[model samples]
Target: MESPDHPLAAQCLQTLPKIELHRHLEGSLRISTLRQIARQHNLPFPSNADLPALVQIQAGEPLTFANFLSKFQPLRQFYQSPQIITRVVEEVIADAAADQVRHLELRFTPAALARAQGFPLNEVMDWVIESARRAASQRGLSLALIASFNRHEPLELARQVTALSADRAGSGIDGLDLAGNEAEFSALPFAGLLREAKQSGLRLTIHAGEWGGAANVREAIQDLNADRIGHGVRVLEDSSATALARERQITFEVCVTSNVQSGVCPSVLAHPIRGMLAAGLNATFNTDDPSISNIDLTHEYRLAVQELQLTLAQLKDRVLAAARASFLPPAKRQTLCDSLEIELAQQIST
Candidate 1:
């Protein structure tokens, strides 16, 4: 059993003001909340005790993409109503605040949230935005939303999501993210749509180089015009891709445990985050699917120090790097970076 009190390292990591740029709302649902929803809605699933095994990765389970993706199947049943959607969004923000994440760009798939109950896409987006705003205001956390499109899904669906996101960009939606199976489905078909999304005043972050290869990262930068690359840990596999990333100063949102759990890396220690950092790539730590992976940004930071052998100073720099790499507009991004610098300096001095 875990101790009641956090260890010194955990405590230290929790105190740092963090930024999470690659978190998915669908994957961040609390197990406790899921259980409550399951019981209240009478969904077809096991009892509360057995629910975690379905939605969360287990210790002995095969850590493959198929196994990891299977968890979300059971999750879709829980988004049964607008009220449930709003509640989950509020809880996600509350959980992030509790984890000491000062700024968060939460990405959500409209298709996943809407498909379960056949809710209209616009209404779903509205509920998420409203709930996020309420939660952020209540907890004093800076929050933003990113609309995510799946590669395996139809292009027409992608087009619809892009249109909705672009229409709502000024309200609270900050960016567009390409997320889904990168191994079988190619990102090529949606390149024009993503480029148009960028031109429509929405920022872009492509999920590439995890299930795919380093060349996908190059395509994301050159073709899709992504402002950032999600899980581009494989960029080091190609020297040219690494050089291009460096030249473009593209930020790589590195989710260490997610990669290991998804079979992208052999183990936590074998993760290329260290190599990405050493190669002068602007790499930042994130918890891609916090609840699904049973982690938070604090856990990722601690893992960086313990497993990846990152010094406290180096970890601090990466925290700042995440702030700088945020999808916020220029002035707001700078303000966030400056505020974090002051708080981080104070923490280090103490």
Candidate 2:
């Protein structure tokens, strides 16, 4: 149905250097890779299941956040060992590099993996950090880790994970994030943990207002002092909150298809990304769960440019914004910025 020369499709696939600020590590694994890993582990996978149908579940009419979250648990079997985690990290980096993503901020909940594998939380953190270093070296892409806490988990446990994540400032695990179903629990419950995390010099990025409301986004910034928001698409509903986002230059990580698949937004056209940009809010596109959504950063960029009709120049700026919001060091940030400019110029000249 679509061809390379198709005007809109061509514009969407422009090979611009990209930066992914809000990618879930577990969610980014390639579905084929997921199957391979399951095979390697001798884990049960349905033989006659609808592969394409299951992979593109998000592309269906619409799905609730609960329905979307259900897909993640089926792949939990592969996340048991540090070796597997390390391998997944390497594969994730390779996928990003293949997508031409120059920078990535990956989020994961260490507690879940630790509990699954009978490993301590700190040990899991150590393995992820080490594995990330190896992956970065191979791809030459900057990567940062954001340790997450399941919202439904005990508040004290979340606080502990936050403390542990912040304890290793210059080493790895750059920040703390509160993730999982936003509507299932209150962000207020973790306010104390977030405050302590900020005090320890670690940055904060929270998953708010995706399935929740603008109030959740408001509280994440006001209460948790979140540096950036993960999928705060609902912020447009509250004029005051949206204005504050613009005033503070708070970044909102927009995952287009993911929102539709997760029922956070109704349709691709109904997405509020353009509205947020029009309101002067800082927003950038990302693939929240590349594996689950069956897409990648380049695909998302294409969707924004083609289906969403964002100009190439605007997409260029969005890539730059993603790099700026990422947790990379200043020197690395400049390198990414320079790479983006070079790629943009090349695309134009071609």
Candidate 3:
């Protein structure tokens, strides 16, 4: 089980100046805001007292993928308008800023957003992009939007999202990610589009090996050419798979809490991030879905130290590693690395 949150300790750990690379915009929606939207749209959701259980993983729930995936179903109903879409993006960013998350790469599926209201794909992308551009600026946060495609969706939908991402690369979109239903779907269907995304100058990240196995991790690296692997804790299941990732030096955006909640890991204590590090693999801590798991980056940092037995020094190393692995271009990436180095130097074993 995870430990109780220490608010003050979290304040100090905030000096990682926190860089988060794997958070999902959809999964990051505010529960209270969801309630407001529910009332406004007359969406048939549970009353306020019971809403969290519907959209969030409750204690003692079966920690299985199907149970975890079901949480998003109620959420899908709330994106009923463009104002609602933009409001969610802005609030998610604002929440990140409040957490002292200085650098965040928020990945969102346009198809999911568009599907809810029958909004056009490009319109959904623009709503997110424009809102993110404005929100990050107002908050003085370094935020990037990753237009993610669900692997289970039609390959044509993926292509349309990729093309839109490529067209708006520099403006607000900085990366593309393949997310969703990794258990049943293969990344192969969207491989060519991902490769084309890379050529179009959009960085690639693929969700693999969390619900599936380590072979998916290998596939993400070799086939999809992922710049980073999302929740690749299962990569240790296969030695050759582990070796391939180590050789490529692929960054694994390891989400400690989400893995436990989703049953990817048996529990937080059993997360393989430390083992991944020992094997010379590059790993970074991230909140896969802060709202869904009822956790923030601070909660994850606390776990990294107290439960995972990571020294604050090692925690700092992971933050820098995430910064180095960010999809930002050479100049901005170096600047982020430089700034994090200065801030992380302020913390010590506590």
Pick by TM-score: which candidate is best? 1
The candidate scoring highest on lDDT is 1
Model 1 over residues 254-332: C-alpha lDDT tens digits?
A: 9999999988898998899899989999999999999999998989998888778876778889989989888888898
User: Which sections of candidate 2 miss by over 4 Å?
Assistant: 1-14, 48-62
Instruction: Give TM-scores for every candidate, taking all chains together and pairing residue i with residue i.
Output: 0.97, 0.92, 0.96
Give me candidate 3's TM-score against the actual structure.
Answer: 0.96
Q: What total of clashing residue pairs does each candidate reach?
A: 0, 0, 0
TM-score of 2: 0.92
**CA lDDT, every model vs. true structure:** 0.90, 0.81, 0.88
Return whichever of 1 and 3 wins on TM-score.
1
Output the worst ten-in-a-row residue range by lDDT, candidate 2: 47-56
- lDDT-wise, the better of 2 and 3 is 3
287: Cα error in model 2, Å: 0.3
Steric clash count of candidate 1: 0
Per-residue lDDT over 37-106 for candidate 3, one digit per residue giving the tens place of the 0 to 100 score? 9999898877899999999999889998889889988888888999999999999999999888889999
